[model samples]
Target chain A: MTEWHDAAAADALSDDEVMGLSIAGVPVALFRQEGAFFALHDLCSHGAARLSDGFVENGCVECPLHQGLVDIRSGAPCSAPITEPVRSYPVRVVGDRIEIALNR
Target chain B: MTAMPESEATYVVVGGGQAAAWIARTLRAEGFAGRLVLIGEEPHWPYERPALSKEFLRGTGSVEAITLLGAAQAGEAGIECWLGQRVTAVDRVARVVTTAGGRSVAYDTLFLATGGRARRLPGLDTVPAERVHTLRTLTESERLRGALGGAKHLLVLGGGWIGLEVAATARALGVAVTVVEAAPRLCARTMPPVVSGWLHALHEANGVRVLTGTGVAGVTGTADGIAVTLAGGGRLEADHLLLGIGIEPEVGLAAAMGLALDDGILVDAQGRTSDPRIFAAGDVARHPNAFAGASLRLESWANAQNQAIIAAKAATGGTAVYADIPWFWSDQYGVTVQMLGLPGLGTRAVARGTPEAGSGCWLMLDDTGIVAGAVAVNAARDLRVLRKLLEDGRAPLPDAWTDSATPVQRLPSRPNVGMD
Candidate 1:
């Protein structure tokens, strides 16, 4: 089952910016890579570095703590330090408001 | 009816380290029925490096744990274990290897697992066997352990992993220690900036003197003790001096054989050197990596095993490529510091948890949007997952670096000598 959860306004983040927040009591990383927006669970399975605190380039995010990289859309690590992928949520924008489905 | 003779395969291994031991084991496990000859300069067998700094130094893990071969075991495997002999040279053209003790051993296939030895500080003259020490070999470590209690001023050279570890141990023993490193930061070659900074703080907090960006001018012994002069025009009077600068590959035999050497015996993806019958692995061999598109020399315990796996398979008819991310670990001030994948600083650093406050992981990112490296402190479980991901072409999360700034995390205090 899929349900809508309120996220943030589309203009809240600048293009290529990343913001971390919590959804459904789960820590999450919100990213704006290229022109797309992505919502992923914040906690890195490998350890404590927040997914939001990682680096982003070429449509992927790298954990700053251990240098493990994850894809913003799929929450998958690209290499090293982090071996596990993070969690991803379904997202869409309604007018100026952006919402994500964390229950999917 | 006339019958022709069939040539029997033979296996020859060089080195007295763990990699050589494991390769020989793998050869037998793969069901190879061939004559095996293992030659080593040391009279003893294989040993583990992890213990060399800890219990082995403390005289707890006996020589048996460090010994690579057992007579009964090798006998059962039908292996010839050569001891107390040095390989004077190798004739690659003739497929023959000779020992200084006057014996010529021929081989169908060869494995050079020749490991590494402690690197000497150039300017510092050799110390009288008693007061000066370096802790790469079990023998030196064991001797140093006994003198640990008597050291009033300990001047340790180098700020790399070995230096930090020894400092931590000396500090734990309540011995005053001063570390001299010429680099701007400790472990400058291997770890990131933040990690080195935290270590500097950790050692200083423990009352150890960590002088970075400083060089040791020279060391001369007087009637009182050894005088350690610094580059910045200072002097350190110490009872004992321990130099842990680094290690160098033991490639004397390889060079004598003229096996197309660079910094080490150069090998291809399959660990095959210029002489096809001769292959090298572990710290002694510089092999090409398809992933990095360059030749690399690896000295970590993990690297040794991984390289040995490749050499063994190739020696047994498997031609797998030798390529994997380099990883290394060290324990300092009770932190299990593990580095996965090689990384250089690229302006992006993410701090998970609080390393300064104690406990967390660090991720260093590069411009390519891939994780160049990941560092974990006191987190081995997570490192495994991260290690696996990197191996599978996966990187960690992409974002800014962070930490739990609100509160400090309390960790289980570590034993003084527990880290490797």
Candidate 2:
């Protein structure tokens, strides 16, 4: 089953900003790059660092703890110190609210 | 100079730490289809060492969690790993390395990432081996973790990063911990006095008995516990003892090969050793560091990975220089402390945010008002921004830089006019 959860307001995050929130008890990071919003698991797959606290650049977020790069759109690890990929969610802006689809 | 055909040549990497692992992975990632061999003394594949003292000791992290390059990953990357095989000798003339198990592997190029081993205390010959411990390998960390489970008290020698991290982890496991350092303050060699004082206070607040300006005169093991005689004519008892003095670079093979050595295997900016065909990285190589303005053997995780990547690229005929600014981080008691650049070059320290509240950073500025270094505690985001600013030789005006009200990202910065 697919469940859609309202993450935040569409304008809550500016360009190149990441916001962390727990949707259905799962930590998710909402990133705004360019003009589109992408969502990925908030926790880093390699270490205990939060991906939301990382620096987003060139469509990837650099893990603040280790500088590992993770693609914000596909949630694939793009650099060393991180081999596994974080889960990505389907995000859509419904009116003024940002909604993320999570598999149950 | 002509480059060898990628598929015809063979590249060998010695050691199984993060550096060696990255070298193997990077060799394959850079489109090298040659025979890649990784030889390591330990049986296990390469894993990150930071969590061994922190999460792994606290029983929260698993071996899989810390495993950086696994067997399957190595296989996928076409890296043939010779685990549990110690490289006994390097025949520079023959272009081959011999293992203790009598296996010889020839290579067109070799990477020496033989990191280091934990420095052992001199006077612990009388103590039983099981009671006195030094954490360097996975097996040692596992043994220490097992011992801590039943231990009542842990006496950690040398209040360095490793010692303090283990102390913090032991405290989290409900074990009474005491740290004794011969230096005047904790992490005195790496951190400034203010940062060291903050760490001392943090440890004391967490119920850790920290003794500075003290040394262990002798150690004796008994049936039930271990006794440590202090240099100041005092004695202390603990269930276990961990020697966290430091690490001695594994320069045995490098020295035998007649490579230049000064504290470690001396390497150029590209990690090339005395011989152009041989390279060294990680804790074993004392390469010229642009940030410190000296040849330094950095033991941090960042340097291990980045330096290995650069060395691997250079070995494969790439022209990348290893000139990254030094960055290191340590997590203790839910607080993350990160150090960037060289703090030793700072003449003035400016505070950003409320450090007492456990969310701030200290910006170290040189005499010319340029940001020389930074120590951030739970403020990685600000440090990230500051790193870029530092790279660009930009500094925020001194007046508004220290104001906690102004956000670090919003702090306006101008190019350093005083510096050329």
Candidate 3:
């Protein structure tokens, strides 16, 4: 069964912005890029750091801890030192609410 | 020796570290379908050394997690890795490298990424072997981590990056730590005075006793442990001691090969060594940095990766010059310290954030108001913008550079010198 939970308000993040959110004890990073929203595991694959604290540019998020770059849309690591990719969560937007499917 | 015909290009990279791994992968990535072999002295696969002092030592990083290349990746890349094999001699005229195991391999092009080893202090040859430690590889880190797990106190013998990092990790693991430095401040050679003071205070605030301007005169085994005598007539006894002094470049192999050496193997802009068919990179390659006026060796992670790319591309017949400003970072006790560009002597620093607040940025500017470098502590986001500004060789307004209200992204961009 698909489990959907309200993450935040649709307008909480502007274009090219990101924030940290927790869903069911799992840390998640929400990013708004080009009028759409994407979600990824909040933790960096290389170190113990939050992905939301990273810089977002050119459709990728640079890890604050190690400067490892990860593609936001696909959660694939696009740079060296980071071989693993963060898990991506499905996102849905309805009116002013942004929801995420945990798919538990 | 049988003279094998060199039909396919066989590229061999010496040393199994970051530089070796990158060169092997890059050679394949650059469409070199020939044979690639990596020779390493260590038994294990190539792993990151940074985590050894920080996360791995603190029990947070695992052995498998720190590996740079796994079995699957190596197989996929078709790289023949000869781990634990030491390259004793290279027959340059014959284009063959002989290993300690009596095996010889021929290569059309060779890369000397031999890297370096930790420097040892004098008069400590008899300090009860297990009591002294110097971290350089994963095996050394593992031994130190194991020793720290049962040890009560750790005495770090230097105040440099590795010393401070190990001190921080020791503190986190509930081990009493003391950092002793001969200099008056922390990171005296690499960081500015403000940063040094900040780090001294940061270590103090975190319960690690930091002693500056104090040198370890001698070490003797005591009834309890080892007694370390200080220069100023002070004494400290700790269960274990770690020497975190700088490293000595692995130039013996290159020197034996009759390559040019000045502190390190001299390389040109394309990472070519003294010989046209041979190249060097990473800590072992000392080349003239465009930013720094003289030839110097960089042992940072950034240099290992970027320089390997330049050397690999050049070996594969591509023109890639290594001109990027050197950058490095150190993580200690939750604070991430980063430095971009060469903030050497004569560069003035302007502060942007409060050092006492545990977050700050320092813009290193030349006399002509050009951005020469930047150092940031817990300010990685702002560092991204500062790096761009520094690369552009544009100067930020004096007021704006130091103003806390000025977001780095909003800093006015200036026309890059020689670009427009």
Candidate 4:
């Protein structure tokens, strides 16, 4: 836990909340699933739906536009209209904060 | 756990569709000597699906053009046809299936080609009888076909593949079809956004009213027809309502049998599920894919046939896994659309054909630098190569589509039987 830098404070996103941010102008959607923060590319695989506005369940987010699913962990298109994986970022949380690297 | 025929080798096919027909045809082609029994709920010989949403939905489709095999010929092939009888339950343990007519049929090996049912419009109330139509079964299609006048008002619900195909058909028949989909773009649940935009343009050019990001709130039936009220605060008046929304696999019989289901009858690559003997196919069987390492429920005609062949081979003691690259085709507004591999874009994509040009293919690539999947419209020849590349894990140079696309000279014709 000490090796990673803070990407966001704990208050930035609530439980089961997904928020979008940009690091170096690269759009990313951050999801707080099970007290852990994971990030995926903002664009949904099937269409131009924003993943930030989707429903999160069982470690995957369902796209709001057409219900295409993506795994929060691997950023892979889990089901329907999407079979490709979304690019994931290395996110780490420090004391009372969240941090993500822009390497993706 | 396919039962070795006990009583006179009864090969009871529980459903009648292209897959079932292919199983019967392939059995004859492979010189199978089992007594064939085809129990179809539809009361007609199997037909092609290419016409179901397009030509058949309009009034121009003739029955002869769609039916692949005549009943007499099927009879000659020793396939006893049972029409209008739906199988209610399947007792895999007893190796028997019961129909709605209180008839129990024992089988050596049963083929569940039950297929799927068209996803209905939300709320069953207030829908006009002939005005609302779901294009899946021939009975429903024929009804819609007969009711489609030369210039009528049609409101199609959903923006999926089936909805768009019906839209193309209704538009061609000089009918004003307004497709209302809650999704932001058409085919958003299937194709890439680039392709969805192209399809949106295709439907728009053909004079179809495509309203996205809106759901059908309710239906109002009147003397003229039905009026579809949208969630986005608009009303669509229509003489007929054609629903092409989508379909869910008919897993009623399978569910009744208490078999394992991972959204469908879960099966391994060889089509073996929890219960060994009872294998499922067509929109119902969810099989583990070697490439994805996940249980995938593939709902394509190609997958249906491929899985059936694999299931047959496996049943006949051939230990082969069905590992064919999934392929699907759609014809709309006189354009041939072929979808070949699958890829998670932003990883990579090589455009072989310009979808905007109304004809071409796109080669999708994965991080491993291999052809993950490919899609082409009116560029079948290129897709064949792409299919090879994907299945064989071959990656051509990044610019493969520039020199790869060629006019599809011909298509593999479905086998036809002579009337004589």
Candidate 5:
């Protein structure tokens, strides 16, 4: 089962920016790129680092701790030293608020 | 030696650390269907070493958290691992590696990613093993963590990255720490003098008594603690002592094979050793670095993974050169310190902001105004931009970079359109 949880204000993040927040007590990283919103688990799949603290470039987010690249839209690892994919969630902006669908 | 078909060729990687693990993974990813064998002396799977002195030492990270390649992943990737086995000899002519257990594995291509071992201070044989520690492996880190759990005062010899990180972790655990370094400044070998001063201040501010320009004359274990005599005739006592001088590359097998070695096994831009069929990477391979303008054997986590990937690709019929700008980072006391390129090659140091103020970067420019290196403290975002500028051989005017009104991402650089 999946439930949509309100994450933040639609205007809270600028284009090509990422913000980390908690929904249902689970850490989630929300990114806005080219006016589209994408969300993934906040933690890096390889190390104990927050992906939100990483740099977003191209179509991927670079892990600040190890420089591993993870695809933003799909949460798939795009580079070496990272083989596992981070969990991505469905995000949508509704009524001036961004909501993420999380499977509990 | 007989030439085997590509599908039947056996590739043997001797090492169980980051480099070896990556080599195996990359080989499989590159669709090398031949036999792959990975031999590592450590019993555990391949894992990153950065957390040994930080999270692992603080008991906040687990073995599972640091593991890079787990058993399930390795098994699925068709990698054969010989754990707890040390390579005793390498027959270059025969293309076979003999382990200490008398198991010999013949290979079409051999990779030496032996990495290194912690350099121990001489003349400490008299001290009890329980009181003195040197962290290089998971077992050593875990042992030291257990000791730190009950310790009140910890004495650290050598104020390099490992020593300082362990000291910081100990302080975080409410233990008093003292660090002694023979150099004039902390991390003097790699860091600039100004950055060394900043690290000294950071440690002192964190309640760590840092003794630069100091050396250890002797160490003796007492009934309840360890006593260290300074080279200048000063004495200090502590519940435990950690030696974090540096690492010595494991080059015995390489040397026995008569492979060219300078400080470490000499490798080309493709991570190819003296022999055509054998390759070396990671902390054990001294390869030519374009960024450093010299042959360097980097021990950072980035080098291990990057170089290994390059070696794996080159070994599997791919043309990839290992020429990435040398990058390294350290986390201490809530601060993330990152370095790109060779800061030692800089003639002028340009400050973007006050790094000591928590978030800033020091751009190291050469005499020709090229960005030779950079040191970023809690400014990883800027460091990413600086890495690109360094790679492009581009540099913004010092005034433009230093100006706080301009963002780093928007900094303009002189294009090298026609420059040779």
Candidate 6:
């Protein structure tokens, strides 16, 4: 069963901006880029650093700790220092609200 | 340059450390279908070395936890690893390497990533004693970890990265630690004065006595413990003494081959040594860095992996240049300190965080107003953003640079006008 949770209001994050959100005690990162919203696990796969604090560039989030890059849409690691991919959440925007499907 | 062999020639890499593993992995990943061989001196697989001083020393993990390229992975990658085999000679002229195991292997391309050995204190016989140690391999770290368990007090003879790290680990283990540095400040060669002061304060706050401007004249074993005699006519005692001074490049095989070497094997930007057929990387290779405008040999883990990849690709007919800005990290007392780029001489250091706060970022800008380098203490996010600005030669607003409330990304990165 899929657990749908409202992580944040869609307008809270501007384009190319990232914010940290807690959905049902799961640390999640919300990223808005190119007028679209995406979500992924906030914790970096390489180290215990928050992905929300990472820099968003070229549709990828470079982990602040160690500079590992993860694709915002696919949660796939696109650079060195990180090999494992983060768990990406399916997101949908409904009436200025961001909904994430936590496949719990 | 030796001609490519008619038969299937093997891509041979000496030294089974991080650099060799990356070289082999990259060769196969880049579609080099030739035979691949890795000659390692250690019996175990290639593992990450930084953890030897951090998590592994703290008893939080085992050797298996830090293994980078295990046997199974090597088999899957079709790499023939000669573990515990030492290469005695590299015949660069004939394109063959002789191993201590009485075997000679010919290679179409060769990578000499013969990293380095820990620099021991001069005139010190570092036998397998419980009281004296120098960490360079897994065996050393394991022994030091075991010694830490029964040790009451520890004396570290250097204030470099390894020494400070081991001091922090010992302090965490409830071992009374004293770090004696010959320099006036901690990490004098690498760190800025502010960062050095910060590390000094960090160690002192955590019960580690940091004695600066003190040199160890001689070390002698006492009846029950080790005694360190200071050059200034003083003595200190400890259950164990560790020497974390520095490393000497393992250039024996390369030097024997008569390849060009000053402090290390000289390599070009493509990681090519003086000989076209042989390439070098990691601590053993001193190559020109475009950023620093000089040749340097970096001993960091990132350089080991990245430079080896470039060398591997170059061996396989790729044009990748190994000129990335150097980056390194050290973990001590729960603080992750990191550095990127070259803080050239004569640059001014500007702190982005409060110096008194003990955790902030320090930026070194060249006289031309170009951001040259950065050192971050627990402010990795800011460092990441600042790294880009440094790479782009952009300068941040002075008011916002030091303000912690202002996000680093929000600071404009357009190159500072008239600074070029």
Q: Write the per-residue lDDT of candidate 1 for residues B1-420, one digit (tens) a residue.
A: 102211267778988677787677667766778788888776676665766665566455687655555777788877788877787777777778788889988877888988878888665555555778888776678788888877777888888877788888877677899999999998898777888888899899999988999987788886756888888998988878888888888888888777788887898877888877778888888888643447878778766766786788887778677777777777666666787776444345677676566667776766655566777776554555456556666554543224233211112112111112
lDDT of 4 by residue, B279-380 (tens): 566677888776544667877867776776676666555688978666787888888787765543314566755767966777665565555566677765
Off by over 4 Å in 3: A1-4, B1-7, B344-347, B413-420
Off by over 4 Å in 1: A1-104, B1-7, B66-68, B345-347, B400-420
Model 4 C-alpha RMSD to native: 21.0
Per-residue lDDT over B112-216 for candidate 5, one digit per residue giving the tens place of the 0 to 100 score:
999999998778888888998999999999999999999999999999999999999999999999999999999988887778888999999999999999978
On DockQ, who's better, 2 or 4? 2
lDDT of 6: 0.85
Better of 1 and 3 by lDDT: 3
Each prediction's DockQ against the real complex: 0.03, 0.86, 0.58, 0.01, 0.62, 0.69
TM-scores for all predictions:
0.73, 0.95, 0.91, 0.73, 0.93, 0.94
Instruction: Pick the TM-score winner.
Output: 2
Model 6 residue B190 CA deviation (Å) reads 1.0
Q: Could you say which candidate leads in DockQ?
A: 2
lDDT of 5 by residue, A2-85 (tens): 689999999999887999999999999999989999999999998778999888889899998789999999999999778789
Candidate 4: segments with Cα more than 4 A from true spot: A1-104, B1-8, B343-348, B366-370, B403-420
Instruction: Decide which is better by TM-score, 1 or 3.
Output: 3
* Chain A (candidate 5) TM-score to true chain A: 0.96
| lDDT of residue A32 for candidate 6 | 94
Models sorted by lDDT, best on top: 5, 2, 3, 6, 1, 4
Kindly list the interface RMSD, in angstroms, of each predicted candidate in the order they appear. Answer: 9.1, 0.7, 1.4, 14.3, 1.3, 1.5
Winner by lDDT: 5
Candidate 3: clashing pairs of residues: none
Question: lDDT at B122 for candidate 4?
Answer: 62
> Residue A68 lDDT in model 4?
61
